[model samples]
Target: MSVKGQYSATIVIGVCGVGKTSVGHALALALNADFIEADDYHSAENLKAMASGIPLSDEMRLPWLKTLAEAAEAARQKRPVVMACSALKRSYRDLLRDKIGKVQFVFLHGDRDMIADRLVKRADHFMPVSLLDSQIATLEPPTSQEDVIAVDVALPKTEIVDIVARTMRTRQNADMTALNSEH
Candidate 1:
């Protein structure tokens, strides 16, 4: 399961309560890669705003995103990284890619009702369920051209991890094949 030489970044992106953390952790385990929780990079001010049911402005998020990108780049230098990030907007994803090249994203999406139910049961998270709507509204789903894959949140975390891990292996094989042919 160790992804040797496939050291690019893999991002698990989604809204709150979409199982990004759970899936990202398992995916990292499956790939034998380092895991980073983007939430851990949030500033105290941003956390307070979200905790109080207030959505943060783009300006407020830019600094946090930049910090996370830097952290991810550092991690990538040592090992492949699987990061759990909200990455709600295209600009945010672009920022990550601009900072760390060869980024791949796993976009977890599901019905609002399903996510709301999960959020209600999530007891130990800083993000409030009230802000779910704002997150969803702000989400700019990755387009076909983006180096991304859409995975339904309803799937079991293990299944999601398996799918992403297999895809990474497939991509690695394809990349190797192309490289070999180029010689």
Candidate 2:
């Protein structure tokens, strides 16, 4: 399941409470890669806003995305990395791609009610259930052409992880074959 030669890093993206962190951690472990929580990169002000049920503006998130892009590059130098990020917008993913080439994304797809239920049950998290609407409102799911794999978050975490790993491996192999054919 390890993407040792296919990609250097992957981003686990979704709306709040979609288990980005949990799944990303498991994915990283399965891939034998480093794991980073994008929430950790959020500024105190951003944290305050989320905790208060306020959604962050694009301007407020740009800097954080840049920081994550830089971190991804750094982490990729040593080993593959899996970063959990709420990259709700395609623009945000584009920004990351601009900064760090060869980055893959795994988008955790789920229903609002399902995610909201998880958020309400979550403890010790800065994000509140109230922000779920905003996050969902802002999300732009990845298309087929995008370098992303959309996985159902409703599935068991272990199953989700397995699917991600298998899909990534298959994609990598296809890419390698394409490259070999081109050469």
Candidate 3:
């Protein structure tokens, strides 16, 4: 799909090996939004460590997370954006909340076996399949009160994006209804 324009700023979140990048890319293309890979914000040292199968501490990840949040917010120049972030824990999502106005998250989830399978087959990335266990172990699914759409990662890539897009439209309609009620 051709790049068009950005859509509503959003977070495409999930554990490692859950196809966040691929699905996010598809969603961004469908919505005509710019996509940002949160991994790009990682430091060289962090990348090297992860490449060696080291899990980054929250302390080590905080600054990079903040940078990603800031970059995502900054990218909203009268257009929408799709940001791919692990956003494993609630606190991490909170850090990005302020920056992402009308933020919605597309959460991709799968069992350990499925994710591990994908990770094992994955290639040419700094994150190794060996580290999949660590990520799944650390992941904290989004709770109530967050704008989140959870999709099963086992679905084909196109279906995953379709699920998010359909859900997103529904969410927008819900929000509009609430706003109308408030007035």
The lDDT values for all models are 0.88, 0.89, 0.82
lDDT of 2 by residue, 1-183 (tens): 224247657999999999999999999999999999999999999999888988999999999999998998898888889999998998998898788776788999888888889989999999889888888889999877667888988999999999999999998888778878776
The C-alpha stretches of model 3 lying farther than 4 A from their native spots are 1-8
Residue 7 lDDT (model 3): 29
User: Per-prediction RMSD in angstroms?
Assistant: 2.8, 2.7, 4.4
Ranking by TM-score: 2, 1, 3
Candidates sorted by lDDT, best first: 2, 1, 3
Worst 10-residue lDDT window, candidate 1: 1-10
Distance from true location, Cα of 126 in model 3, Å: 1.0
For candidate 3, the per-residue lDDT at 123 reads 85
- Candidate 3 all-Cα RMSD: 4.4
Off by over 4 Å in 1: 1-7
Q: What lDDT does candidate 1 reach at residue 173?
A: 86
Displacement of the residue 98 alpha carbon in candidate 3, Å: 2.7
- Cα lDDT of candidate 1 equals 0.88
Q: Write the per-residue lDDT of candidate 1 for residues 1-183, one digit (tens) a residue.
A: 223335468999999999999999988888888999999999999999999999999999999999998999888888889999999999999898888877889999999999999999999888889999999999999997777888998888888888888887787788778878777
